[model samples]
Target chain A: MRTSITRNRILTVLALAGFVVFLVYAQTNWDAYRLRILNLCAVYTIFAVTFNLIYGYTGQFSLGHAGFAAIGAYAAALLTMSPEQKAANFFLAPIIPLLRDVEWPFLPALLVGGTLAALASLLIGWPALRLRGDYLAIATLGFSEIIRVLFVNWQRITNGSLGLKGIPDHTNVYWSWGAALVTIFVVKRLVDSSYGRALRAVRDDEVAAQALGVRLFTHKMMAFMLSSFFVGVAGGLMANLISTIDPKVFMFFLTYQIVGITVMGGMSSLTGSLVAAVLYTVFLEVLRPIESPFDLGPLHIPGIPGMRMVLFSTLLLLVILFYRQGLFGQREFSWDGLLNTLARLHRRVTGLWGRTPPPSTVEKGEQ
Target chain B: MSRKKVLLVWLTLSLLLSLVAAGPVAGQEDEIVIGVYEPMTGPQAAGGELTMQGVYLAHEVRPEVLGRPIRLVLVDNRSDKAESATAVQRLIEQEGAVAIIGSYGSSNSMAGGEVAERAGVPVMGCSPTNPLVTEGKDYYFRACFIDPFQGRVMAKYAVEELGVEKVAIIQDVAQDYSVGLAAFFREAFIELTGDAKGIVAFTAYQTGDQDFTAQLASVMAKNPDAIYAPGYFGDGALLARQAREMGYQGYILGADAWEAPELIEIGGSAAEGILITSHYHPEAELSPASQPFVELFMEKYGERPSAFAALGYDAYMLVVDAIERAGTDDPKAIRDAMAETKDYEAVTGTITLDKNGDAVKDAVILKVEDGEFKYVGTVKP
Candidate 1:
């Protein structure tokens, strides 16, 4: 047992070392475009894990992520944009008096945006958490649409449909990956606590959990608000990375994308979300040629413009159909699994090289 | 386990290596790369395709500048704001383009503008008419007139030529172009008539709204002499049909967005008498230098060029002319040359950029006659 614990510690140290090495190498060697794509992957990882916390563990079907994101994006954008930019971008109507001169640095603005989104989610969750199944889904969907419409018409604050431009390019590898790591750590800690067990119990059997004196609404609200806060920060990072945003950027389709990621990864597994986010983000950029004109030898084929989404959906469908429980199911990366597999491989190699070892002898040796 | 980890690391390394290899490689330094982004699919595709046609033809005419071949890198923005931003970044960074031209929709152009401004790469819009697109951004410019000028021209045409006193407006609130143009038109029209009640009614609908009878019902109740509907062709057609069917006989005035073949097809005969202000019309006899371009466009595409096409052509020619004047492939130098442009002959008209980097030119007034936009006259702005 002591050896196993030591092995686990060694593996964790090695994993962390590998991560640091990757960060140093990427920061030194990558070009602007590659670095931007890497940062986007990190942002998506945070978003995906935050979304999983609500839909996976809490068993809440929330579809207002885009709405919350839109709030965050606008809050951060308005807070960070210079007063001169606000005047210029809002040339038609001119920005509202209060927000015209309000400019905060990137970090404070991002924190404020997340806090505002969490408060907004708390308000939305008051009425929304009472419902279940598709009813809750439709209500949340309507909320997102309302948010988009309000942003579009509220010209003084949102600059109307023109959206805000010239948001400072502040997102980088450190900020994005740092946020992603913080999210994973917090969510893992939460899921291990007693509160997390109650949330899961509600997810599995709401009525039975209610009978056991679990506060369903409070547990759901906690998960919802916490998830929304992280999602909001992720949105702020995305706006800074892209350097612009509009109401159209947070369409219902954006929520659908989040849902797709949460499902494709195992909803119950943060590691699955991390891996899926990286694969999805990198592959989206890598598969650009399929939607673009490219010379492949002598076969000159005109690009199908929207082929990326088509191929992406088909790949997603294959994953869901083949693996019912998703990539990692409800399981996570464990040191025991690694150690057991390593022991079996060692025994097999020894058996093949010299004298064959009995299974009982191999078990004794491992002990 | 360690061997498997080694194999995994090898696989990841090879993948990263392949991606890096697929990135833009260093080619001959003499070829000047120019990037163009447009929506090839989605709601605004027709406008994007028309603009691209003009740009391609312009490229065919002048493919060399400063004794170096110009290579055009065209990217599809998919009519999405985020995609538009990424497209411009890819153009400037990964593609190593010196100057960029693009984007039909005003919102999409704004997205591209943010990226170009941050990267210090110059981007010229072909048909984005929003004033904010180029405002306060040194790196962003446009070859088309802004919404204020277009709106004033249409309002002048309505009051003087069409002889309209009272008017109603239906704008697409979701579209920045439509809302901004409508506001400008309302201000100009009210000033011309010298009465606050000159514009009797104002209503709005979101983009993708198909049923406009409700909005039209309220608009018709005001008993206005004319209806100013500034929106895209899809909504424009349905509004015209519905307004005419509801027995409102006043003229329907529109903006440059109505210059499309699909407008006539969808609106049919109901669109016959609609008046619109445009960048160019086939029947207008302006510069003789543009005759060859018009003929070539008609011969190649089997149709007359729309205003977007003409603007696209003008934008491309202007960029190439700036590159020639700069005598260097440097982006900042090209930007200076582009800003110094004066009275350059373009297919649309003689183009001279004002202090705000907007073209100071004439807006063509066209009336729908016999399923086509026939030239009436031109209004200088």
Candidate 2:
């Protein structure tokens, strides 16, 4: 066990180094479009990880991710937009006097956005966390709608439905992926700490956890607030990368998409969330060409819009149907797990399937 | 021992498989690509489809310019703001499009505006009426009159013709176009009537709202002489039906977004007497270019073209004309020629783009009658 721990530590370092190399490669070589898509992947990774920290690990099925993101996006956009740009956008109603002229750089703006989102989460979690299961889901969903409506009605702050445009393009591979990495690290640390175990205990059994003196609401609030903070930062990154935002951008559909990805990734595994984010973002783009008109031999396939989404949803359904517990379940990726799986696959290819060690050997080894 | 960990393996496998299957396709060769980013799917799909019909019809009418066949690279913006910018970028970076034509929704155009501006490729909006779509962007141009102009026209028509004194405004607060048009119309109505309280009631609803009783009840309480609800066709039709069903006999006015035939079909009898400020009605063909387009549209699709389709057609033709006049398919050259466009006889009207890159043209008023939009008259800008 001690040797395996050291092995995992070494592999973790190697894996992180590998990620840095990949980021450098992508930054230097990828074009503007590819880089944008990659940056989107990073932003989405942050969303999935933060969501996983709450919904996956803490077992609170909160649907207010979109609402939190909206708060973050608006806060960052209002703070970062130049006075001239704000004036240009607020033709119908001038922005609130406080946010009109203020222009901070991207990093501080993102932090402020995240902090606001976190604060909003605290306010929401205080009341909504009293409910459990489906009620909680509905409450969060309503909260998301309320935020969207508020963004639309509060024209002075959010520019109403017109939204803000011309957000400076400050988000590159480094900013997005670096933020994503920070999110993953923070979430992993939180989920592995004593607070994380108490949260998980609440997930497993509220009665037992409460009897054992676990303060349910406080722990739940901790996870919810932290998750929302990262989600808010992700929203800021998205606004910066996309260079435009409106109230409609943070509709319930955004939350649904995140939920779908979290469900596809394991409901409990941080690595699963990371994998799901990359798959969701990259696969959407990769599958897009099928929608565009293209020629095949002597036949021409006219671009069929909406087909890609259909295919994507179909794939998602299949994944859910075949693997009910999600992709990673409660498992974490380690060097030994991967190496053992590879060796088993090699053995099955060359030798007998029965000769391969049973899958529980790793489970027992981990215990 | 639940195979939950297998989720990563399966996901990896599927992603790899898809990456291989969706191998990079070859790029087009020796053709001037005109990128089109419109919401081909999603909530605004109906408007996008109508605009695409016009773009397709225009392309069919003139397939080539400057001795090179025009290849359109169409990308679906999915009615999303972020996707709009990405679509624009993909068109410029990957497809090498010389120009772009798009986007029915003003917000979609607004999102795509900056990307095209940065990339130095021009985009021609088909029917996005919000002035901000082309307000400060040098690369953005449009084929239709802007919201401020149309709003003023509607306000004038209401006062001079309908003689509406007390008007209520119900706008889709979620849509930039609806919000801007409603605001402009309110300003003009107040200005024309010379009454501070010309707008008796102002209520709002989100887009895709199926019910409007809450909004309608409040507006009816004010008992306004007219209700100017300038939203998309789907929402407008539903609102019209609800208002009529609720026994509100006042005039119901809409803007260009209410031009779709679905408005009549959806609202049915209630849609009758619904008035709007529009660009082109099929029967009110303004120029010689109008008749053929209407005829061609009917022949091709066996249906009458909506006002948006006409604007879309004009946008495509304008781009092609600019390319021909510029004597090159270069994006910079095409942009220069586009700004200088004047008196271009288009299906909608004679379009002369102003210094702001907005079309200086005439607006038309249409009324839904007998399951069709009948042309009332034109409002010259």
Under CAPRI classification, how is model 2 graded? acceptable
Per-residue CA lDDT of model 2 for A1-367, tens digit only, reads 7888888788888888998999899999988889988998888889888888998888899999999999999888888888999899899998888787899999999999999999998888889999999999999999989999999999999998888887888899999999999998888888888898999999999999999999998999999999999999999999888888888899888998898888888888877888888988777777777677756556777778886788788768767877776767678776777787888788888885566556566431231
At residue B51, candidate 1 shows an lDDT of 96
Q: What tens digits encode model 1's per-residue C-alpha lDDT throughout B1-381? A: 343354356446545533443443344678999999999877778789989899988899889899888888787887887778778878888789999998898888988888888778888899999888888788888889899999999898889888899999999998888988899999999889888798898889998899999999998898899999999887999999999999989989899888877889999989999898888876776566578888989887998887889889988988999988988989999999999899888888888988788888888988889997888998988
Off by over 4 Å in 2: A1-4, A297-300, A345-367, B1-28, B208-223, B245-247
What C-alpha lDDT values do all the predictions have?
0.84, 0.87
| Cα lDDT of model 2 by residue, B151-241, tens digit | 8999999999998999999988888888888888989888888997988998888877899999999989999999999888899999999
Where does candidate 2 chain A have its weakest 10-residue lDDT segment?
A358-367
Chain B TM-scores across candidates: 0.92, 0.90
Position A101, candidate 2: lDDT: 85
Maximum-DockQ candidate: 2
Which one wins on lDDT?
A: 2
